[model samples]
Target: MGVYNVHERLLVARSGEVGALLDTLSSGGDGDALWPHRSWPPMRLDRPLAPGAAGGHGPVRYTVTTYVPSAWVRFAFSGPRGFHGFHEYVVLPVDEERTVLRHTLAMNTGGPARLTWPLVWRPLHDALLEDSLDRAERACTGAVAHPARRGAYTRLLRRLLRRPPGVTGKP
Candidate 1:
């Protein structure tokens, strides 16, 4: 792998219970509620996802976008500029009820995207990965008790869930 390769893997949910969660992860996230009074705008979808892209390939593709609000958020990058990267997740069936999600994130620095991370983003990469995945777990947990979606929160969640990602819904 190239130095550009940075990864984070977490077993938050069982192999079987992660399908919907995987869908939500690859799709995007809603920050309005989480941020509440913060000025951070809603999470946007540069791309919407479809289901079935479970293996090396899926029946469809999904993609989502997010940005760090404060420069001090501490993550893949915690410097003057924030870190922005797109994540792809693949949801696979481990057993009847177990599904394995493999997540992969790609970020570019210095060379392009008008983006750059601190010189040692690798050290902090794992922490950021864990944080993002933990948040995803929270969303998935709510989906279980919550109705499919009844209000504005559900509306945004739906938007995120719809983007199944062309790649595995792992991340």
Candidate 2:
């Protein structure tokens, strides 16, 4: 299966201001203003934010393949068994005080991922990206006009996934 997902937000800030957020990924600790790490798994890189740096969140693993300072960064997936492709975050300048922060995930899934991608990963991925966008907007504008909320199914999945294998409910 081929999956292409995109999430974006338009911030009322300069491109330079918005783009600088790219540099803070995995480096800003708990105060990372762009990645929504408080709610989801934090992104971690073995080295600084540069090409060849490797790391990912949770089960998804990737290596930084391209980076253009505060403008763009791309990661090529290297694990989770069947995902092949790249995901990237790009900053586009719309005008003097408007910028678009976009994230794109394009990949092909084979083997078990063909099933897991749709039933398991997609929902979580969607929620995570929206939250990321909300963080970006809030960091740049002081607030989020509309915050992303996880659906009931997503909440249930998160709860179930958090439990240890062979452990069921309240023992």
Q: What tens digits encode model 2's per-residue C-alpha lDDT throughout 43-161?
A: 88998889999999888899999999889999999978899999999999999999999999999999999999988888999999999999889889999998999999889888877
CA shift of 62, model 2, Å: 0.2
Give one digit per residue, the lDDT tens place, for model 1 in 87-120. Answer: 4445545556444444565544334324323333
> Which structure among the candidates has the greatest TM-score?
2
Worst 10 residues of 1 by lDDT: 69-78
For lDDT, the strongest prediction is 2
- All candidates: TM-score: 0.37, 0.93
Candidate 2: deviation at residue 74, Å? 0.3
TM-score of 1: 0.37
TM-score for predicted model 2 compared with the true structure = 0.93
Once fitted onto the true fold, the runs of candidate 1 whose alpha carbons sit more than 4 angstroms away are 4-17, 25-43, 50-87, 106-125, 139-171
Q: Which clashing pairs does model 2 show? A: none
Question: How many residue pairs clash (N, CA or C atoms closer than 3 angstroms) in each of the candidate models, in the order given?
Answer: 24, 0
